[model samples]
Target: MSRLLLSTLVVVVVIVVVVVVVVVVVGVVGVGVVVVVKVVAAAVVEENDYVWKNGNHAEKTYLFLVTNTLT
Candidate 1:
């Protein structure tokens, strides 16, 4: 009976660990997707390619410039 209980506990622990790992991986992947989408959308909307300073003006640029400048 003790052995059976131990085995059940172990199984439960393994299942919990697996679930936590999966959740973390999914969260990380979701964040990555959001960042990529934001970047791509910014690039498409800005119409001024990121890192291109040619013929640049202050106000016409997108919000990326402010963050880029700070970085």
Candidate 2:
């Protein structure tokens, strides 16, 4: 009976650890995506002279700017 209980406890501890790890990884990735989106938006705003009404392809615009700067 004690061995059975020990096995059950180990399983529960492992499940809890897995859950915590998944949550932490997902949270970090989520924050990183948000930061990247905000940075791109800010760059677009600057390129448009602080106006956010440009109908152009901002992602391509930024890519072009980066490509130009690299070469």
Candidate 3:
């Protein structure tokens, strides 16, 4: 009787863990999709290719230079 109860408890724990994992994976994938879509949209509208090494990003606003002063 004790063995059966232990086995049932283990099975329940495993099911709960599986559910939590599935939910987390789905949430992560959803967020990734949104980010990719935004990046693609930004890439389409912007002229310069952007990356981390270029000090460029999809979220940055363009600044038009109006004046320059040098000594």
Candidate 4:
């Protein structure tokens, strides 16, 4: 009976550890994705400034509105 109890306890502990590790890994990955997205968006905006400036007034206004909403 004691051996059975020990094995059950070990299993529970192992499951808990695995869950915690997975949560931590997912959290790190989520942050990394956000950082990468922000970096890519910034790069695109920098490279497209002239394109935006050359667009019509209505297009420029819509672009600014979208960019403002995002930030």
Candidate 5:
């Protein structure tokens, strides 16, 4: 009876250890994903701002060309 109790205790301890390890690993991976997503979103916003600025420059150039041609 003592041997059976010891084996059960060991099994419970191992299960608890495995569960803790899995939770820690998943939490770390989730944090990494969130960081990567934030970086990518910032990069996208910067690219969009650059494109918008270039578009305005092009519009000004087009207007200049049209006014010069008319003159």
Candidate 6:
């Protein structure tokens, strides 16, 4: 009876460890995706002087502008 209890405890401990590892991996992946989306969004906002394309295959328009600021 003592040996059986020991075996059960070992199995439970291993299962718990595996679950923790999986949770950590999933969390890391989620954070990485969010970071990538944020970077793309920021780039689009910064380069607003460039033309925006709705389709991947072709360019639709051109933008030209001039600005000077010294501070």
> Which RMSD values do the candidates have, in order?
5.6, 7.2, 9.9, 3.5, 10.9, 9.3
The per-prediction tally of clashing pairs is 0, 0, 0, 0, 0, 0
Candidate 4 scores a C-alpha RMSD against the true structure in Å of 3.5
- Per-residue lDDT tens digits of candidate 6, residues 1-58? 9999999999999999999999999999999999999999788656643434342223
Model 4 alpha-carbon miss at residue 31, Å:
1.0
Per-residue lDDT of 1-71 in model 4, one digit per residue for the tens?
99999999999999999999999999999999999999998997875696597878887888789879988
Each candidate structure's TM-score, on Cα atoms with residue i matched to residue i, is 0.65, 0.69, 0.56, 0.65, 0.72, 0.65
Best by TM-score: 5
Query: What C-alpha lDDT values do all the predictions have?
Result: 0.78, 0.82, 0.68, 0.90, 0.83, 0.69
**What is the per-residue lDDT of model 1 for residues 1-71, given as tens digits with 9 covering 90 to 100?**
99999999999999999999999999999999999999997876565554344545654455456657966
Model 1 regions lying over 4 Å from their true place = 48-71
- Give one digit per residue, the lDDT tens place, for model 2 in 1-71: 99999999999999999999999999999999999999998886586563334435785677568757976
Scored by lDDT, model 2 comes in at 0.82
Q: What lDDT, from 0 to 1, does candidate 1 have?
A: 0.78
Q: In candidate 3, which residue ranges exceed 4 Å CA deviation? A: 47-71
Best-matching candidate per lDDT: 4
lDDT of 5 by residue, 1-71 (tens): 99999999999999999999999999999999999999997996676566656758776576557657976
* C-alpha RMSD of candidate 2: 7.2
Candidate ranking under lDDT, highest first, comes to: 4, 5, 2, 1, 6, 3
Which candidate, 1 or 4, would have the higher lDDT against the true structure?
4
State how far residue 5 of model 3 sits from its true place (Å): 1.2
lDDT of each residue in 3-65, candidate 3, tens digit only: 999999999999999999999999999999999999987875463334223644442333222
Q: Candidate 6: where is the Cα deviation over 4 Å? A: 49-71
